[model samples]
Target: MTRRLMLSYVALALLVLLGLEIPLGYLYARGEESRFAQSIERDASMLAEIAEESIEKGNLTALPELAREYAEDNPGARVVIVDRTGRLLTDSAGTIPTGSTLAGEPDIAAALRNRTTVATSTGTNSADVLAATMPGSSGTTIRGALRVTYPMTTVTDRENRIWAVLALAGACIVTAVALVAFALARWITRPLRTLERATAQLAAGRLDNPPDADSGPPELRRLAAAFTHTATRLQHLLQAQHGFASEASHQLKTPLTSLRLRLENFEPYLDPRAHPSLEETIGEVERLSRMVHGLLALARLENTATTPGPVDADAVLVERATMWEPLAAEQHVTIAITGPAAGRVRAIPGALEQIIDNLLANALRVSPPGTTITLARAPGAGLHVIDQGPGMPEADRERAFDRFWRASDSHHDGTGLGLPIVRHLVHASGGQITLHAAPGGGLDAHVQLRPAGRERRFQTIAVTHAAAGHRR
Candidate 1:
């Protein structure tokens, strides 16, 4: 951003310099050439007047002397005088014969007709020359043509110098603009960079380095102050939530457990017909207890923030399957491990084990005796807990992640938070979880986790340790 801003400033400066300096330099050059042409024209006209008397009387003796004196006064100038009959009378450089025919030259040709002319042409001594030709006339009768030629370098050198100076000045201004623009860009973006870091930290559930409200522009300052307030309020709310979860963990579960135990204790003393009602009441109490615990667990999970790191998905799958094997055997159900290995997957510390445990437990609950519960590693960084039980409808699968949403045909005592908690953990690990029909007609809990390619600074042993609600 800083670089882009600086370049923008420099580009704008260059545009302004080109717009101003180009025309200024061009006009100065044109004005210099105009002034140069006027000086030559004035010199030629004055010489024409000087030569008028000598040429009119046809006295050539003093004309050569006059031309030589004029040439000596102005360096790199050639003077040529042509008579009325198109013959050179005298040459200032003495190179051409005095009677040489010099009438064909454009400036001389125009001047012979009593018209004055000034233009640039090729020179014997240089590549370019500016010549001014005027008729040496007496009483409107043309006597001779007087032409004065100066090297074009006389005017071009000044034009070149002016352009060079303008270019240097423009370059200096552009350089200065770039430096100032760089400084200004940095100054403006420094506060934005601070805000960016603060926003990222806030999104990750902590704001370690809060932005300074008074350090930047007024608009940014106000935004910083608002962000700080929002972060403070969020921290306070999370703290209150954590406190509530901790308190409710003990308060809510104790009464529910006591109620279930008290109701069960009355089973021996109650009438036979009352036993059914008592059982149902106890079951409701147990379900309520599970619901309270599930909600508290969710609250606690949401209160803490964690970054996902590499975990050996295959190892966790095998370990979980082994752990749940005894429960499956007790129900005469077979637990089968299949499929290829799911390599290192991204998961929060100890989250993979909890996810696998929850999915397998749910699978085993619906699975019938003599049926196989398959624990498989799907393609890529994925896992599947396939069971031989009745699969849910497509609509129910979509709402399965909602808290306390139970399937209509669910028969077992469940709090209906198993799928929700599983989804929460999966999503926190940057993964997706879905329920599909198994091959033989059961629910296949398909979980797709991100692949952890590089090593990170985390305790990889956490993946093998116990997970939340692992024992329960």
Candidate 2:
């Protein structure tokens, strides 16, 4: 856009220069030609008058000598005398023979008819010439005709010089205009570019600091203000929602606990036929309670800002694997771990643990009996979870990470919130997670995070317990 604006300015300037300078140049040349002709006419008339006087005084020889002197004084000029019957008497430049009948030239012809005339010379010898002719007379008697000619090279040279100056000036003006246009374009667009970056940062949920709204054009400044207003409103709405989810989860847990206790106490007295239905109801209530707790944890993670620090990847994987071992063994499944003893990555507090717990739970839900689940870490702060179970279809991979999404053919009774939670935590910690087909058959989940220099603590045992309780 800036380039287009500057080009538009330069194009308009060029058009204006062409419109103004072309005619100006032509008029200047014409004016110089007219002035040169007028000068020649004046010189011819003066010489003609002198010739008439000399003729009347019977001093014909004096005329030739006067013409010779005039020609010598003014270089590149010619003088000629001719009789009324169109015969040349003398030639100052000696180009025409004396007494030769050569009054056929247009200016000489006009002077023989007793009228002054001015015309440009042409033909082989006329390179560029201005000629003026006048009839020499004495007391109403026309004497011979006098013709004077001057080279027009000087007139053309002056016009060329004028055009050269105009060309230089036009070039300078266009160059200056282009530079000013570039500066102006940048000035107008700089604020817009800055606003664009600020908008992107705001979209990524980093609203702790607002963009400066006072630095651009009036319209853009107003836009910045609007953006800031919208961002503040969004932050307030999210904070309110997070607070409500947290408070609501905490408030509901007490009642849910009471209900579970009541169900347990009443189970002994319930009939055998009614026991399964009662147990199912209790399970549903527990699932709801787990979902609420998951929501609260997600809200907290979303609200929490990730600090720049390292996490103990090795410890996190070891602890999570140990925690899930008892449940895995109950299903006749084994857990395998591989990686360095002290892997490190940049992550928020409790982030890696939450991610590992969710992925491990998700993997356990789908793994077949006696199958081994592989937990491994690689260089570059990468983690992998490979499950020996029926993996989802190719098209369902991305949708699996969406909240409340589950595979249509799956037999597992999952709340379908695990991967979404994992994905959110991974992103918050500046990492990425992807689900792919495992080797042979099953699901493979991969996570890559920024490498950190040293280890730090993880604090997500409460969240893990909450999710685990629901699964059991």
Candidate 3:
């Protein structure tokens, strides 16, 4: 943005300078040429008056001496006298023979025809020359032409100096404009850059810390204020929504408990054949109760602000395997934990546990009898929950992490919120979860976590071994 702004300013300045300087330079050159030509014309006219007397008397002897004297006074000028019949009478430089035909010269031709004339020449002298020719007549009868040739070095030098000055001035102005534009661009875009960074932070879910609105230009200040206002309102609205969910879920448990107690109280009076329906009703009630807890947990997960730290993911896998071992045995399923217990990743405390618990629950639900469920460590601080069950097809796996999504063939006992809750927790803790086909015909639920910096705990085993050796 700053570069564009600065270039725009410089382009405008260049355009203006070009418009002014181009015509000014042309005029300067033309004016210099005109002034030099006019001076030579004036001197030629004066010399023509003197030559008229000498030509009228047909005494051209003194003319050469006069030309020599004129050439002595003006060093770079050539003087020539030519008659009306196109014959040169006397040459100032003494190179051209007297009586040489010279009528082809434009200035001499025009002067012979009774008109004063000026011509610029690039002749044999290796320098441009300005020549002025005037008729020398004895009472309107043309006698000869007085031609004065002056080298254009002085005029050209003056023009060059003028052009140099113009160029220097133009350059200076353009440089000044460039400096001012750069400074102005910096001033203007600095605030805008800050606003851009603040906007990015806001988009990245840093809503609790609003952008600073007190600095920058007035327009940007207003924009920042509006951003802060919108963020604060959104923050409040989300808080209210989550607060309602949390409160509603908490409030629902009491009535649910009371109803369960009442159902238990009525169970004894019911017939034994009716016991199945009663049990089903109790199961539904318990499902509802579990759903309420799930809702509360989901709400809490949404609101949970995770501060990342190192966590032993392998240890988490082992711990979850140990905890769910009894349940797996009852289902005739084996839960196996594999990989190093020292592997670590960055996540919130209990986040890995939450993810493992949800995944283990889902795996246990879908696995068949005598199948093995492997919780293996994947590369790059990741975990894989591999289950040899009726694994999801490609279509169902894509949306498995979506809220309340369940595979079409799966049992209907679950609330279908486990993977979604896990996904939220993993994302909140800067981790990723994906479902892929396992190597041996099962679902591989992959969870890759952000690697944590190695802490002092990583060195503890080495340090302990060293201390033991020293004691021995």
Candidate 4:
């Protein structure tokens, strides 16, 4: 992330530099060329005026010497004199032929037409040259023309120097920007990395090494402090849960042992008439044992160390449906299952199965005879358990997951821990369950499971059972 941020910052900076430099360089070059042209024009006009006065006075003897002296004083200028008929009369550099015609030259032709002309050209030395021309006149009659050529080397040199300075300044600015970007990126990302590592350790059940609250930026520091507080609260809650499970198990053990011993001793002397009551008592003891086991399981699940694994929700539902079929049939309840062919969820297999079993048992007990109880998978990765029993009101639904919460005047003999156990197991698996009214007047229990990668197989099974003959 830091690398990405730095790259983005640099890219933006380069774009800004490009936007500023291109137009500025073009304007600078143009202004330099304009100033060079203007200087050449002004010098050419002054030389033309001096020559016209000298010629008018019939000072032909002084003309060549005056031209030579002017050329010597201004080393950067090329001065030439041309007659009315286009002959080159005087040349500053003697290399040119003495009588070369200047008729075809662009600036000279313009001057002969009585128009001052300025033009630019390139020389053999690869330097820019600005040339200007004006006709020599006395009282508006043209005699000859004076032409001056100035090399633009000095202006070119100044531009190069300016460009070099700009390049150095740009380099320094870019370096400073990069350093600031790096420091800011580190300031932002260092705390986030530390928080991420601390979160991983906490999830692994290492409560001893909570993150330091002093680390990171202001927002991250506040988050770290909040996380520390949450961890402390979680530790206390887990300790209390463990203590409750241990006490509850101890409280249940004595009665379970006495009941088991009585059953064993009474079986040899029992008649067929007394067998039903003994069996009923034994069933209640087994149910008690299951509830105690569920409590312990729930306590273990609450610890952060437990991570749920992938399981087939459809398979779990099918298995529980098969196990409870006989009981549902005896109670005169119709059990039907319907859904997609497969669905998978992440959860503890045993705990999930137990939750399904408990919901099935409770539904069968409360449902009227010949009523249809449906167990269907929801549209996504979830289960829906619907029963034709007296539905819970809104208030009851709110408190339904509390331990030992049973509806008023409920006929079924239940420890009232079924819904709470289901809630705990679902929450541990990172899922949720909701209770509502079923269509056609009954209770609906919705259990949503976390979606997993692989598909699961699902097949609906239906069973018809009578209520009077139902056995635990």
lDDT of 4 by residue, 182-260 (tens): 8887777776766677778767666666666675578878887888889788768878878888788878878887877
What is candidate 2's lDDT per residue for 199-225, written digit by digit as tens? 777767666556567775778778878
Cα shift from native, residue 259, model 3 (Å): 5.6
User: Where does the lowest 10-residue lDDT sum fall in candidate 4?
Assistant: 463-472
lDDT tens digits, residues 1-472, model 3?
9999999999999999999998999998999999899999999999998888888777889899989999999998889998878798899998999989999977788888899988888867688899888999766798889999999998988989998999999999999999999998887776677667767765555664565566656787788788778877887888899999999999999999999889988888999999899888888898789888988999987776667788876676677789999998999988776654446777788877887777777677667788877665544444556776655577777777766655566545676677777778677777676666666565666666676685432211000000000000
Ranking by lDDT: 1, 3, 2, 4
Sort by TM-score, top down from the best: 1, 3, 2, 4
The TM-score values for the models, in the order shown, are 0.81, 0.62, 0.67, 0.60
Which candidate model has the greater TM-score, 1 or 3? 1
Could you say which candidate leads in lDDT? 1
Model 1, runs deviating above 4 Å: 1-8, 51-54, 57-80, 88-102, 120-129, 149-154, 329-340, 367-394, 408-412, 431-448, 454-472
lDDT of 3: 0.77
Better of 2 and 3 by lDDT: 3
Better of 2 and 3 by TM-score: 3
lDDT, candidate 1, 349-398, per-residue tens: 98888887777777667666788776655454445666667666677767
Model with the higher lDDT, candidate 3 or 4? 3
TM-score, candidate 2, is 0.62
> What TM-score should be assigned to candidate 4?
0.60
For residue 156, what is the lDDT in candidate 4?
Answer: 84
> Model 4: clashing residue pairs?
329-465, 329-466, 330-466, 331-466, 331-467, 332-465, 332-466, 332-467, 341-458, 342-456
